[model samples]
Target: MRYKLGWASRFGVALLMGILTFSLVVTTAPTQIQGAIAQATAAARQQQREQQVRQVRPETYDLSRYPVTDANERHWRNVLWTTGVVEPQEPYVAEAIAQIVSLTARSGLSRPQQRTVEMAMQIATQLYFSNPTGYAAIGQQFLQTVERSPNPEWSAMALSALVKTGLDPQQRQRLGDRLRQRFPQWNQDIYLFTTLRDLALLQQTPTTPPLGDLLKWTIAPNQVHLYVICRPDRGVLCQTVVKDGNGQFLRENGQLWSIPLLLRSLHELSWNFTRGQTPQGIYRIEGVRPANMETFRAYGAYDLVKLFAPYEEGVREFVPGRPGQLPATLTAYQALLPPSWRNYFPIQQSYWAGKAGRGLFRIHGSGEDPGFFTNNNRYPKSLGWNPAIGCLSALELYDDTGRLQQADMPPILNALTRLGGRSFTGYLTVVEVPGADTPVSIAEIEAAINS
Candidate 1:
């Protein structure tokens, strides 16, 4: 294997050479040469300073003094509802999940309570995944669900869920055969047709999504890295190398942003189902919500960039950034990708997820500071970052006195912003790439783009 130097190593070498050249020119070259060399060195130093400034990092805050207010309650409550935990009863599970997640992030979680919460979350998600189409009940319950449910949608969802869970073929089909007989007319139904077509896909051998020439990121989409954030020079994306699909380096107006996001949903359930982890897929960026209109303590001060799944909620509204209309069919949505990544299944998750009745995903900053909690990190890999109800959440730094300081949402919104201050009708694709514990670093992104 060829040995590779990291960004720091490469920079160190370049700095060394620049220093040596400057020393030689200053010591031995004539007056005019020395003056020219001095000017060049100063310009280079200024450029380096500006380049470092472009790689913006959010300021950290101490939140221990701030009390865990109703915002935390409301955030967890929303999570509970997303996980199908809504009821007249208090959301005990949400509390546990929140506690576990917070604890896990900053400090080690060895409490039995942590195990209890994990098991509870696991059970809740399992119940959701298994019952969606209704075969996990087995024997009488399974038969009755398939045969008796009047809703053809339920039956279709059940069969598709069965396919997704790797249920036995013969058993799945036996129930599916009954489902077909029950809903023979459902073949024409748009929702069922879309779902069952996706089910047929499960039977086929799964292919790995291609790492095309574009460094299309499948982020757990955090680390606040933007390849295209700009650098003052005619929109040249200064240092750091992540190329966009059009084979050009991207710029975010000379200011690269880092929005700490965890694609892992608070539910931490299966990706394909509703309220699961942020599914690996491409979504349409319609615009940023000018204001949340709710409590700022949960959502923060940044405007949320709204995301739409293909054919989401049966509406294809107009967007100013992209020409023509929204994609209505799978082929059209595939048009969202470069020709190279069209067949990649993971890249198309938002489409199927939308088909499965999941939407309302947005890119927003969080207000739930983990510093106030004891245990809340079973799912989010980042420190102090909170999970979402399937929305892409960016990190929000606040002051010790409970005031917002820095956020990751604004730059992303800025990147997607269009002429007339409209949000771009562009697409944001998230993929779960291989390599355990691997982050979407600049080198990795460059390698994929160059490859």
Candidate 2:
């Protein structure tokens, strides 16, 4: 039985083998097709994601404005970035970093000049997000370089860089201790106070507000008291807070003025001193002129809080016009001052140059009529974003409807009124610190949060 059917059975075996091979091919075809489709879908999704990243990337700053030949212009721009006046976009950051690196390889800059470059490097690195490790290394090197010198400016800048890099506490503490021991001869309390705050922050200890305390420490000995710290460069949009005698915040009746402030205009700069820029120091709010008053009405301000005349009282005059003028009144004023106070000007003039004016500066309502379109002028829009004469710090009252509201008036009025109505006693103390020739970065804010 076994021998007779062998050749015929071999044909059946071959047919069965062919059927199994066909079935295997049929099963695997769908798997191969599915894999191809999945690969195509993934590739399409990856392209979409890349497009999204490209579309949403931040715009680069215009580098042509900072030509390499113009060191003053470039340095000024660097100051702006360091102080948060102008935030450095990625391109600016990279450009600054490259400049610093190149400058480091060569030598010949003066100490102050070198400090400026180092400061710019600190600012650029802190703002940059892409190269944290590289930035940190540069910051460390900067710290070492500055530590060798006794210059507090360099020390302060280096400390700022360390703060921004989020240096570890133990290392930060050691550096801070060294800074404290090294720089007692430094005159500016800003350096000491700022470094103190940085040290406290690093060690996880309590820190007094650097600017607030610095202001308090400076003015504490003087007879004039401060009721509010009007920092037009703080908080959301901009925060100016009112403080009490103890330096505690006064929240009553909207004492906190959280509104945009207008700075300076080109036309105004021609005639008016301070160049329409907000002054950087403390000034006593000696008196107030009401809106009904003819003098202020001519100048187009609402309620006027007269800061202590940086010059002799009634000596400097405001020359009124479309493009206003300020006369050289300091010479006359110096004659009237007692010999002691007369010398004070020479010592304090640098600080008071911006603070002093020809006597028309005021925080007031916008000149534009709220309801009517007598003109197409936007007072607040111009003022808040930097367009005012030397005297005007215009408040924003315009609502989303383009109509001005009285809401802006209450906070300023309330603080002034509560202090003594038209006879408020303390300095107006308008500070936009760490900027506009005074350099402070928002990294201070970040350190505060970490603390």
Candidate 3:
């Protein structure tokens, strides 16, 4: 009986040990599996997040793919308005402007277009100021659209509206001044002027010349005068002169000339003097005489010739003992120019002249000598002679000589093409005198031109 009892006790102990081991295994196995699954899921989520980051990274916009055109302008305008990319109260004003633009597009009608839409909204805002209860709701809606837009034109229009709403005089003046300084072009819009004038807003007067002058100067189209003077005492005085048909300078007239005029004049001058000249070109520098020895020392004669010769047939004729003779060291016509100007002349002259199958083709002066004469009649246009009509004169010369090339164009096209369709409008706005910096390269310029 004692042996049987002992056997039962041993069996019970073994069964209890086996049961405890099985329970421990079951609990630990699940925990290890769960931990492994969690780690895998976390790793996969991290990879997906990294991929998402890479997918949405901003890419450089290829301007060439979207060249400036009427269609592209319309498309971009629509995209900006529809996507609320420009204006804030986009839902309200967007549909209105879009409707107007759509009607114009479909009917092929010529409305004031963008400026017209802006003017209409501005008028509405003005009406709201007089009758706030009647027009305030719509004015507020349009104001919201103006606030949301990144477009400068819309911003100008909205600010104009705000001025119309009778803001504090000082505040209105400040805003008007800021807008004028930032966007001088917008200041020319008649709609803006009329709105400001009617509201008695403190806006700057438009810089446009009289209509008579504009019509008279239509021969020049858009041209400004860039004068470079080499005085006897003063070394060099370069000033960009803006002139209307009345022959009054812009500064003297107390107004900014049209930007188109400034740009055209700058481009024409750059093409003629810096680029080079031909019979077709109409720029000329007259009455250039030998300077005193001191004058020669202050401003290099060779530099002057190199600078001006591209545009004119520079002829220096002075005897060794001549009363108005420059220094003997400044004997060479090319040597008269500064080292920098001398070096740049050939490169610039060649770039324009060579491409056109012509040379700068100007005569130069010999050492302190007096027997130089210009065949002004041989090259009537090349002589330092410019007609009253600016671009029209040049065009007439090209037409008379039958030299206007149908295909060959200035190197500007090539340069623009290289810029990948970016407009040279800004860069071309400011006119830089020669010997400032090297102009853009031919290859790069070709790109900009083509674009």
Q: In lDDT terms, which candidate is top?
A: 1
Given candidate 3, what's the lDDT at residue 230?
13
Weakest 10 consecutive residues, lDDT, candidate 3? 388-397
Reference-based TM-score of each model: 0.53, 0.39, 0.19
Query: What is the C-alpha lDDT profile of model 2 across 1-451, one tens digit per residue?
Result: 2311221242233223323432222223445433323322434335533433343222322335543333554554444333222232344445444455344434566655565555454444334322455444445455664465444544555555555456677777777777767776543444444445535644563322345333333232223333222333321123344444454444434333233334443221211122323443444455565543223212222345565445424522222121222233545334432343333322233134433333455665443322222111323223222233444444433333332232243345555556444445444444443333221333443243234
Pairs of residues clashing in candidate 2:
262-383, 262-384, 283-427, 283-428, 284-427, 361-391, 434-438, 434-439, 434-440, 435-438
Q: Supply candidate 2's per-residue lDDT for 263.
A: 40
How many collisions per candidate? 27, 10, 32
Give the backbone clash total of model 1: 27
Q: Which candidate comes out best when scored by TM-score?
A: 1
How far is 411's C-alpha from truth in model 3 (Å)? Answer: 55
Q: 368 in model 1: Cα distance from truth in Å?
A: 2.5
Candidate 2 positional error at 146, Å: 3.9
Q: Residue 359 of candidate 3: its Cα lDDT?
A: 28
lDDT of each: 0.45, 0.40, 0.28
Which digits, one per residue and each the tens of the lDDT, describe model 3 over residues 109-220? Answer: 2333444443334334333433444544544554454344334444444555565455777866665556456556743553334334333423442232122222122112
Candidate 3: regions farther than 4 A off: 1-130, 141-146, 177-451
Arrange candidates, best lDDT first: 1, 2, 3
